[model samples]
Target: MKTLEHIPLNGELPSPKGVALAILELCRKDDATIAEVARIAQTDPALASRLIRQANSAAHGGGRPVASVTEAIMRLGMGTVRNLALGFSLVDQYQNGPCGQFDYQGFWSHSLLMGLAMQKFSNMTGAGASEELFACGLLAQVGRLSLATVYPVEYGRLLDGQDGVARNLVALEQEHLQTDHNELTAALLGEWGIPGALIEPIYHHEEPEHSGFSTGSRPYQLVHLFYLARRVADLGLAGENERNACTAELLLLGGRIGLDAEQLGATVDDLVQQWRTWGELLRVPASALPSFAHMSAAHAMRDEKSDGAAALRVLLVDDDPTTRCMMEGVLSGALGHAVVCANNGREALALAVETQPQIVVTDWMMPGMDGLDLARALRATEWGQTMYLIMLTGHENEDEVSEAFEAGVDDFLVKPVNVRTLRARLRAARHYVQLLEAWERDRAQLKQFAAELAISNRRLAHAAMTDLLTNLPNRRSGMNALAKAWAASSRFEQPLSVMMLDIDHFKRINDSHGHAVGDTVLRDVAQAIQQSARKDDSMCRMGGEEFLVICPNTDLKAAVQAAERLRRMVERLRIQAGETEIQTSVSIGVATREVGMTETDALVNAADRALYRAKQAGRNRSCVVVQGQMRCFP
Candidate 1:
């Protein structure tokens, strides 16, 4: 897991901005009042409205609707309102950014469901404060969003592998980005000053049972509830088999908390209805789900089809032919998978590497090499890292079980295995294999998308810096290059010169022959200027009728010669526009940075003043500024 320092402090995650920043500053004061929070909330009317609506949502227990920010803060408490404002503010600001892999709409939808589920589950189980739990559920997955924001392109690839064999998202994140969402979420919640009561449960929600807290403790129970809420959110968004799997998981979770199947089913139906209303208020997507009992019934209708095509290659190994044949018959018949049988562990390892099977089921006590040895060997290889390995053992010793797992066995089956148990385990393995294949396909597609996005970004950057009319650097780009040249000159004690040139009496061409003629003259003059400029000079269009030339490492005399050359070329230039033969001349001004000038802008202003002097002296000549005095050059 990554530490707080691993997270980029440079606006990578959703920290408070605008009104949210103001509210947070006020929150830092221990004596801040409801009116103060309300005042800050009202500064962003849209965020203020969201806070009021959230305070009255069913997740918070629907009651008399509040009419003002002050009323909402009084009802929801200052802390809850502050957090809500922060959440809404981030939602508004980052709904669309560089995270192409992140589904902004789906994120909010899932969070809203989790929030509603947390509140409902806590109310039924009496696990934690409903209001606080609601906030916890809403922000539970925010760290994932933060990761996407910080590393948009890389995170998109990580999210693509989310459904692969690695079921633990945190583990996958740690492997790839050297950080996990759990640590990030906990760190952010702590920074926000949320009570540990809420933060600890969210930190461990991913593996609630393994969290150090005692099973019946408040933190443990809350963790379990949060996990259940995540499943509910998954069920709410899932379709087909995914929905059934989540329903099965939710049923088991509800049982642990002493809620019977029927009670949990009805409660979820009510929650879904309320979630729809809240989703509209939050402007997030929410689909209506049938009662949990109904979804469970759908699971029954689909169970046979679920095993239709596991599609994964299975490698089955056993020392005895009879046991090997029996296992092969069941797995191939049930899953309709292609099965390869090996009588010994050594042969199994060779076939596994050759065929690259998605799953391997081997007996624990094979001759020469045991299942543990085979599993360990396979895990040491690249392809074997993702392969699902299951050990079949009659030994019920706890130490042996731990050793098998440490050897990379995904699951273990007692020998004389019940056919029903074996079939169920195979089905689970099939699900994992399918997910891995899907992830591989998604990774290919996302890689292509990233390549295309990179190209588009480059085109956009080029367009931003180049002027469309003449295909030259625009004023902004020119100014940036000038600053760099100035810095280089200052460092080397060399002079840098600038020339500002404008077409003399150019408006007459536009007014007499139309602006189309004026455009033609401008294009022609720009081309002539480029043809005359030295290789080291930078040319830019300073918008209609004016241009700038930057000459680095050149003193005032050389700059004056370059300006006169450009002036003579413009006078000799001729442009034909719609039967009108146009002749144009330019007035030039030259300025060079000397001892007393400390800024690039000062040099540019001096050049403009010289250009004004040239225009005053005559419309088609060059003027150079020397020692703060303008001298005309014929």
Candidate 2:
């Protein structure tokens, strides 16, 4: 992919300067009086009116109407006041626009649904970052709106191709604008001086799984909550196909969030109800929303596909004509599929293979090759894979049933099988078959889809963690891989090593040749390092001229050898940039995991110390950290 040029940063939207300043100033002081904050909020008349209206809403349960701003402020606590102020400030900033292709009201309604869902989830999980979640949800798509307002032509072009698009728009934005919504939003929030913790979710909302924020990490979880909430909200706007896609995604993510099928269904029901009420409050028309009735029906249809209470196919084998007829009537007329009968075990085997019956009800004492022999013969063939063999035993000894099991019979039906017992057994067999089929199909499809998604996600993550020009893993991937290797080694009591390398006098190369030539040298050096490392080892470009290698199950001796090899490989590699051949050499530092070294920082620190030693000794060599001391290798 070609690199995208940066968009010029000078554009003005509706500035809520007065409101933003008031909210920021109010939040800044610990000793500031409540009256003083209220006085500041009162300066913005629009904000004050909105606050008064919200205070009287059903959500707040402020039964007695408060006519004055002062009365409202006194009734609501400080935290609520602060939240309201922040909400109003955001509304003032983003509420107005030409929004030619974007539906502002619809966006806000969806955002409101997400906020409600996040609040509910927070309460349920004891996550307790609802206010920040609400704010992030509200502003999650602000980047799109910003682009529409600022870059109208480009936005129009994008909108022209927006019909039934399934790809992530943030990725599209990054492809065209060199910046995604997450990055833009994070930058804007930082510019507005919001806390970094709150800004993180805004920056990493689209790809939460790879955001390096753990579920226990407040910012990461909040973003994940918002992502989930938005999908739930989308249930109100999606078409049938889109809803199915969203539901599948929801179910896939449910296990990660500790929700069972029944619990997830209940949560979806609650979200639907909340979405309806919230839509009404936001003045969004019912026609524009995704209906709860449709979603419920779709969910029901999906469930019916795996209900496992369907009809069963039974194969009845017996010598007596009367007994065979009676069993056929019970299985086919009372149950479902036609029951095929065979007088002997030899005949039954032929029928079993041809009919591929789900369950077999056969007499133990039959004429020629009895039930035990038939079960064993069936088990030896592919027919047994689908059939649930049930032997009819006249003898009730436990040892007899053990012989039946040894012959691959699933269950024993004693002579004169009762109707209720027969029905229950058939049902159980049907359920087992259905579950097996469903699992097989789901596993195959999910594995294929997951493989494709993993590849795409890995590329995106690589892009996020790599230097585009150098084609090497960036600082983030380097650090992350290093940390991961360190943890694995510590946990398993295995050897681990890290190598940090830097190109000697890289700036001189850039100055002597042009930056384009410098880029060629960097790429050549990266290729050399990549070729030097083992397949399992990780090679990363840690900004500018520095690189890092994470080697698992490698001791200090092996690590030094690998680092020296990489150093020599780089020295030998030559880059031709516009007819100028440039040769480069690298200095390397190697550090291995030691006893009592459990943390990543310690390993990195050791490698850094060794790197400094390599620099202090002559350049273009390797140094190792041993027993807290640095030793240089010639």
Candidate 3:
């Protein structure tokens, strides 16, 4: 509800000089290659030592020796190298003095846990971009530290208020500084020129919904991951009451992530152990961490209470005295809820107003106000907004059930309702209510988290198969699709076609416009390619600007037609950047598979040759590779 300008940054927070320097140096064009970056990092002996130690840590499973800096750079790749450089640079930033009430060591340990958890989650879900996510998680709460370091007094005041720290911090930050940590951290990251994807989660971790990132965006998911990590940290730091709250919170998050109870338990255990190990490795004291075992046990006990207690209030309305008594007995004695009984619809309405029960069970053909009439009345009331209404009816017709639902009934209980059926309905209603409550409590946070998580996971999955900047399925996805198509073609004995395409002089485009604009162009081209391909056909972004399209159940002639269509589409793609409208074109390489050959590599290789010929005979054309011969398009 607060504006961005309201939250101000405290001036006293420690300057992130080392972190800033490291980020600046890493972002430079001269430090572009992993080798060059490593050479720069090696200039700092302490950083170099830590990098080597971390590379050989148990986490990386270093059985073979990573003897030199070059080997570490080669083994880990550019992303990891950059992350290590940045991480080690900030390690010493928070190593001294109490920044408000924040225990720096404890905070760092928590950050480490979150980083590991994010990585583990990526691995478990087959999500891509684990390293980027890890970096985001590690720095997710850097804003808080920044605030503490900059404005210790204001932060101390903000923390001093225990009643509503979450709400109060936002208000206080806005009142004094005109910017909160969330925005400040984002600004800092932007200043350092970090990738937009990574910067997104850091800035929007707290208020994910309003961050302008789409739902199912990678940054949103990272936000959720960070929240979960923090919750895990809270569980570690919790007392009995806080532990109970954390348990409930975890259960709610687990449900959102589609983790069943058993899976959730296992994940928590693994995360706790990993946190402990990482804490020791980082020299973070044990006292800083919340007792994992204690929290786990407490959470388990709370979960048992949540499962066993049937505290839901139900209103039972029936004309028959015997039926009313039986329903009351069953709900009260067996199910354990405060069951309120009313003989007819009229009485039920009055009692509903008084009791405000979560579920309503009434016989359809009551005397004064019938079940339908009562349900209608309840639906019109404020109390009825969320209450689950069930009608008891003898009719089993589809129309009857539909009418009941239309009249405001959520479910139907047949006349002579069995105990099992009634119990199941009640259990379902309870679960639904719980979910609704959780949804309301953290709607903004959850929505943002879900979106970011989806995007990141999808991007990672896509990355394995497509190009990063282009947002197309990567070569990996292409290969997988090819294999699937091959299997299907072999099974059905159907024809198949494969096409490979490359943007003409993509490097020139990058050189002409900045790489950022070039990235936008590549993305536009990929979108054009996606649109050109048939819905069933598979399209993948090969490294650089090259792309591959797999057309299942198509002959060479159809493949060529498809290729021409794609070429035209690319030519039509006019990208706009401010006043400039940039035009681009693509060259096509087509190959087809007939009978006997089942391998995908051979088909792909054939397409490559066609693409080569298309490029060789001037740009912006289509060519086919058939029986090992390249034929250029007219």
**Model 3 RMSD vs true structure:** 13.6
Stretches off by above 4 angstroms in model 3 are 1-69, 98-100, 125-128, 162-167, 191-193, 252-258, 286-634
Models ranked on lDDT: 1, 3, 2
Cα lDDT for residue 557, candidate 1: 90
1-634: candidate 2 lDDT, tens digit per residue: 1111244443663334676467666666787676777787788786677556555543443389987777776666555566556554655555546646666666666666776676667656666644444555656665666676766666666666656342456656667666655666666555545557767765666667667664356877777876787787676566676677777777756656888766776777776676566456445433343344456468768765544333556788998888888888878776665577899989988888788877888989987899888888888886586678888777789888888888888888876878889878877777777777788899998998799678777767767877888787788878888887777776788899999888898999989997888888888888888888898899888778888899998988889889988888888887886777788888888998887775888888888889889988998899998898888989
Residue 75 lDDT in candidate 3? 66
Q: In terms of TM-score, which candidate is stronger, 1 or 3?
A: 3
Error of 1 at 334 (Å): 5.5
Pairs that collide in candidate 2 are 236-290, 465-474, 466-474
RMSD of 2: 10.3
Top lDDT: which candidate number?
Answer: 1
Structural similarity to truth (TM-score) of each candidate = 0.48, 0.55, 0.49
Question: Each prediction's Cα lDDT score?
Answer: 0.84, 0.72, 0.74
Q: Write the per-residue lDDT of candidate 3 for residues 357-385, one digit (tens) a residue.
A: 98898999987899999999999987687
Candidate 3, position 26, lDDT: 67
